[model samples]
Target: MLKYYNELLYFAQKLVGDKEKAKDIIQETYSKVLETQNKREIKNQRAYLYKVAKNVAVDEAIQNQKLQTAVYEESEHLTQKHEQPEEIAIKQNQEELFMQIVNKLPKRAREAFILYTIDEYSRKEIGKIMDITSNAVEKLIKRATLKIEEELAKKGF
Candidate 1:
């Protein structure tokens, strides 16, 4: 429990790209995991923790987007307190650029990259999550990396 704190925090931070948000995510993940009797029922405890963390982080991201848009509709710039205008602008710019790169990837390849690279999911677990072979996951990751590299090189990265 205490041992995996840093790992879980790191995973959530990668998923959301925010430290405070990541802390919330980790706390929620712990709460959810404790709610299920399966906590003591699973042999693969670390994998279970990671899976729950991924699900919670992803859900929070999606929910946050909707909430932000609603704030915009109200003619309010700040979705959450402490998010300054310049910071928001920079974040939006980065997100747009990142999505542009991601758009170049095939659907499955992008998903594989998100799971493996961003969420740090194991190859075997990602295969199980995506319902594909681990070999296929490897191939998809390779292709996705190449495509991203090519795109970045075009921009002189």
Candidate 2:
């Protein structure tokens, strides 16, 4: 267990992108693995540790997203107002155009961009989910952003 601490910490940091949060995740992973071990016989401790760390990181991300959404909803509610008909129409058209532009992106780039921006996933997480390297994920996202910007510019947006 002590021998795997540094490796697990590095893995967790890559997943969560924060040293302190990664440490917390490692602590949770160790706790869960220990609790589970006591309840039953264990096999493949290394894989189990990684699986637990990934689960903890994902759980933390979901909890954080929920908290952020709650705060955003509250603030939006406070600032809510009825939009004029023209304003509503303009917003709808802009959204439609944005979707069209996004759809024009190459498949991998589009997927990476949506995962990073719309789904709020970190590059490392996206890479894991997409079965790509983090550098590849970064490149795909940048490519998508540049294409979207060029399209918008052409459209006079």
How high is the CA lDDT of each candidate model?
Answer: 0.75, 0.82
Candidate 1 local lDDT, residue 34:
76
- What number of backbone clashes does candidate 1 have, counting pairs of residues 3 or more apart or in separate chains? 0
Pairs of residues at least 3 apart in sequence or in different chains that clash in candidate 2: none
lDDT tens digits by residue: candidate 1, 25-85: 8899888877774545543345567778878876875676754654355364334632633
Instruction: Looking at model 1, report the run of 10 residues with the lowest lDDT sum.
Output: 77-86
lDDT by residue for model 2 over 14-107, one digit each (tens)? 6667899999999999999999999986544666777788789878978887556544664654433334322343566678889999998999
Candidate 2 segments exceeding 4 Å error = 1-82
